[model samples]
Target chain A: MERIPILRMGDFLLVTIQVDMHDELAMTLQDDLSDRISKTSARGVLIDISALDMVDSFIGRMIGTISGLSRIMDAQTVVVGMQPAVAITLVELGLTLPGVITALNVERGMSLLRERVQSE
Target chain B: MNVLRSGTQAVRIEQDVVLARQTARKLAVEAGLRLVDQTKLVTAASELARNTVVYGRGGDMDWEILEEERRKGLRLTFRDQGPGIADMKLAMTDGWTSGGGLGLGLTGAKRLVDDFSVESAPGQGTRVMICKWT
Candidate 1:
């Protein structure tokens, strides 16, 4: 199994998640990311899901949970590069994420974060 | 007239998802649905099958092929005797999840198919009916 990688980009953190994104791994990633955000005091987070081929209910919920927790930790989150098919499937499953903003690509997501940091 | 096909197999809750995906793929091919349509059916079935094993304590999936004139579709019913959901509305919320999921399973599954219905009660288990047209 490939472990999720977290990298630092200026004040923001970029977490690259590549997996099937199902039950236990999803939950663990959420908890771990939330904890890291608090500890590192990152201003923003970019979650890269471009490599994920499959996502189930549990994984969807975990992503929502992470977004919620990131807010509490005073960090903004951007979901980057979601596959079109995956996005459609998630929408059909009624998993619309309210607070988390999704970007068409990682560059756009990073740019959004830069704007956020500059405004603050 | 209804063309009924039944499959029962002993499988772990984790593996049930695989079975669901396989069944959906087979049905989609047999029905000659487009690749996009096939993917939608597979994704919906994946969510429901995960629910059967994870939340419903494992169960069975029954698929029925329906044809009317030039139209063809497939209906999948998932029956499980697990602890039922007490609150349907809350469970439908995007961020509301008992487990660590993104809580999109039920809602996402609903979006993939043309018709969807879910029935559940506390201590009574759950039944989910979904259909997709080619």
Candidate 2:
């Protein structure tokens, strides 16, 4: 089975998406991430999608769901490294990802998560 | 349809949706469409393909590379023989969902393309067609 790696980075869990995501894969990631969050009790989650060429409504909703789920578990979630074309396509797809935080890149995303971790 | 090249793929299985999206992207790129345009077309394809599998109970996704004088475009058509939607108006409305989704699939796909059309009947099937020009 193809699975995305989740690395522990201090109090944060980092997920770097390096391939195109299909429906089942996205669902699997959501399940895996949620379980890991409970086990590690991480303070934050950062998803890097720089390698993703597109973000459809399904993937967009998956991102939103992951962030929402993390928030309910007392973890901050920030998606980063979205390409310009993806950003445009997502907006046009009517997936604003309300309540989900976003950043320019992984570095900025970490700092954003750190701020949340510090405040909490 | 003024199609220069056309092909059809089955959308019965989940993996077929991914192939549909790839076909749309490749056709857009080969047509020399812009990056943003390619992404938009691919995104639209993904939504429609998923709908065909999940809501339409599996269907067919067809693609065509189009040419009209100097204009070049890619067109995709999704058709299914499942229980068709009764209310087209409600279905097209954002946030109106019958499949536990964000209710953005049909409406969102429409926004990502240059030309869009939908046809359905209660007992008959449903068909959605979209075109993106370069």
Chain B TM, per prediction = 0.91, 0.97
lDDT by residue for model 1 (B51-103), tens: 78888888888887778677788888888888999999998766567875556
TM-scores of all candidate predictions against the true structure: 0.73, 0.96
Judging by lDDT against the true structure, name the best candidate: 2
TM-score top scorer = 2
What lDDT tens digits, residue by residue, belong to model 2 across residues A78-114?
9999999999989888888899999999899999999
Cα distance off (Å), candidate 2, residue B99: 1.0
B72: Cα error in model 2, Å: 0.3
Model 2 chain B lDDT-worst window of ten: B1-10
Model 2 agreement with the true structure over B43-118: per-residue lDDT tens digits: 9999999999999999998888999888899989999998998999999999899988889999999999999999
Give all candidate RMSDs, comma-separated.
Answer: 4.2, 1.2
Q: Which candidate number would show the highest DockQ if scored against the true structure?
A: 2
lDDT to native, each model: 0.77, 0.92
Which whole-number lDDT from 0 to 100 does residue B53 have in model 2? 96
Tens-place lDDT digits, model 1, residues A1-120: 535767877778898886554455676677778778988999899999888645556666667778788878888888988877777766666666778778989999999988886897
